[model samples]
Target chain A: MKTATFLNRDEFLNHWQGHRKLTRRTIEKFPEEEFFTFSIGGMRTFGELVKELLTISVPGLEGIVNKDDKPFSHDIELADKAAALKMWDEQTEQINELYNKISDEELYETFNLFGQYKDQTNNNLMYFHDNEIHHRAQGFVYLRALGIEPPFFWER
Target chain B: MKTATFLNRDEFLNHWQGHRKLTRRTIEKFPEEEFFTFSIGGMRTFGELVKELLTISVPGLEGIVNKDDKPFSHDIELADKAAALKMWDEQTEQINELYNKISDEELYETFNLFGQYKDQTNNNLMYFHDNEIHHRAQGFVYLRALGIEPPFFWER
Candidate 1:
């Protein structure tokens, strides 16, 4: 397989961090009541969606770095938007700490991420970022459905 | 700034191509009438959102490789979703060809993408992927609202 041009690790992390900041703001924009209860067309509530993101990201990266073979779990327990926001903050730090442990060579090594989705380490890392954007976009739609303005997509 | 471990060029392109495939499937899942007309809480219709994705991606990438300083234009002329999908196929080819023109060194070079976002070429490229996922999430919400099932998020 031909190696393609790629962003250096810090650049990738910076890009991920930018999206994370935007997602955090999206969570902040949700109304307290709707955050946990709102749903569109039988989709999960915004809070549940956030829980999925929270579960996948930090633990996912930790698994990648540690070579841990845990199956993916959506088991985060949070009572309110505040607790979720706090967890988001903690994950932000965890990402910074764990991300540095990965070396450039390791990025090309294949890892069975979350005990599934075997791919190059870099691809798995991108999944963490991609998954957040996927769910956050749902939160964006939810905000609109509730007649609230979402923070600008470019604000991050 | 420290360089972080990152995907090789081919890996990044492959990752992007996978997401594009899923997004195309998302577009196909939309009901034609709803594709152009449906919205929740005044968000842009799914067709319009797809339009934004189509407009930004290939043109933005073209600018990056050519060193063109064109400001962003949402001026893509498409009569409907079918036309949009045809253009998407063309752009998919365009991405494969143009992507290779961007050497690894070019990924780190800063360019004024869309004449607005001034960042490393790689980050700008990421903005393309991130923006597509964001809008496609909106399409997912629209599909649910119309009682249609979207393509699975991980299917890409």
Candidate 2:
């Protein structure tokens, strides 16, 4: 895991947060009724998808930070969209907290997420950054389907 | 936007298939009875997630190439997993066909996808790559839950 060093932590956080803000804006524009409605078959309603995004990142990043592949619990449920949003806000704060704890050297270290796919200890951290952009695209579509315009994607 | 050089088209296809193969392998490692039953609450069932992944990348990529943001109309009745998988396979083939038509230069052009989100066309391509890796992380955990070891993430 040589350095995936194009951007330092601060720069990465800025871009990451910028994109998430766009995602949040997209979430904001949706009609509340369709929040839980799946637009296409097998797709979670926009609300369900948003809730899933909130759970994955902070916990996912925690896994990356410690390089510890923690077992995901079955109890990872949100009561409602409001609860999900509160969870999201809390997770955002956690991201700010956890990200600052990482050293520049740590980002380049191989992350051993064990008992699952990826045995390598050396891994590029940028995969996480890139993954968020990917999910946000799905978010982009939900915005359009709701007849709202998504914020400019390249503002970051 | 600067040139967003990535895995070549062939490289991209190979990696895409490779990831899917590993994903299927992970899915298979689980008992058949649990395939449709598994869930991490806010997360999707492995069966459901795989079906949806099949829908997003290929069709999503194809839409980007044609600059047509066609939502999956047939999936409107999408509660069934089998139908979703069929749509997934068709979309995969469609992606392979459309992806072949994309020249190296077209990767970087400005793409007005539905006239909403716009960016250097090259970065748009990278979004396709990044999104899959992100979702695949969840699959890895689903694998672990069923006592399966997923393939190395960077087997590419």
Candidate 3:
């Protein structure tokens, strides 16, 4: 029996990119000092969360494309919001390039991600979206608490 | 020209239900008192957030299915965690029922959600997923802050 396909490769790319656009705006909304330092209820700062996203997207896609099982790392750092946005823009491009390298057929193939999580390529890809949205939502709450209005969620 | 389909109806339903399952687990992990009263940085309690979810899912879908453009409401209240879970389970079933009433072709039809937000049925459906994941992520932060280990996200 043939497995059902959810999103065609292009659809997935467009959808993921839309989410990235919104998340990028979310990152920009933060003040430099607060972006890295603010937290509510002992949650990590939004910058730390953003760092995890930056670490995941391009690196995770590259791992899938290169068949590398490197350990997960959030070791990268940025000097300020400007540096972080620059890296985000760069990885947005890299994600597109690396994502296209994997054919539609490959989406179903199982692969180990970050030498720890193993799942089909499609699930791993979905996880990328899930992880980013999870952190971005936290950023939303942070913005609200800080008395800043976040960009509309449906804009993406 | 034919528009590209992202997810088939069943695929969308299954993906959505998976999110619902994980969200239910997140609700389950909260202590009854904290679920309603505990919040950080002026964020609403997880219980309030869950009430919003409860309000949106069934009523929103009912709007879609019946072509009823009702105003958005988060007025529904539950007495305890048990009551919330019971409502969630009932809505889970209602979502399945109401979702099936929309054929694959109708997924492209535009509807004004809660008589305010208007978009294609497909996008509105996606918003359901997006909204849940967004709040659930907040719930995750709440859980961590309360020294609770929330369920693994990937389980869904």
The top-ranked prediction according to TM-score is 1
| Ten contiguous residues minimizing lDDT sum, candidate 3 chain A | A1-10
TM-score of 2: 0.48
Write the residue-wise lDDT of candidate 1 on A78-149 in tens digits: 999999999999989999989888777878888888787788888778878888898999999899888999
The Cα error of candidate 1 at residue B64, in Å, is 1.9
Residue range with the least summed lDDT across 10 consecutive positions in model 3 chain B: B1-10
Give lDDT tens digits, candidate 1, residues B23-60: 89998888887777899999888888888888888888
- Per-residue lDDT of A44-126 in model 3, one digit per residue for the tens? 89999999999988989889999999987897868889999999999888988898888766677889899988878877787
Tell me the tens digit of each residue's lDDT in model 2 across B28-146.
45556666676553445656656656655666567667777656321334444455456655766777777667665666566665355476554554455544554555555555545
lDDT of 2 by residue, A3-121 (tens): 11222346456556776776666666666667766453244566766665665567666876776787544246665556656776787789888767666555545565433535322
- Supply fnat for every model shown: 0.88, 0.03, 0.31
Q: Tell me the deviation in Å of residue B95 in model 2.
A: 21
Q: Output the better candidate (1/3) by DockQ.
A: 1
- Full candidate order by TM-score, most accurate first: 1, 3, 2
TM-score of the A chain in model 1? 0.95
Least accurate 10 contiguous residues by lDDT in model 1 chain A: A1-10
Q: Kindly indicate the candidate among 2 and 3 with the higher DockQ.
A: 3
What is the CAPRI rating of model 1's predicted complex?
medium
Q: What DockQ does predicted model 1 obtain? A: 0.73
Highest DockQ against the true fold, candidate: 1
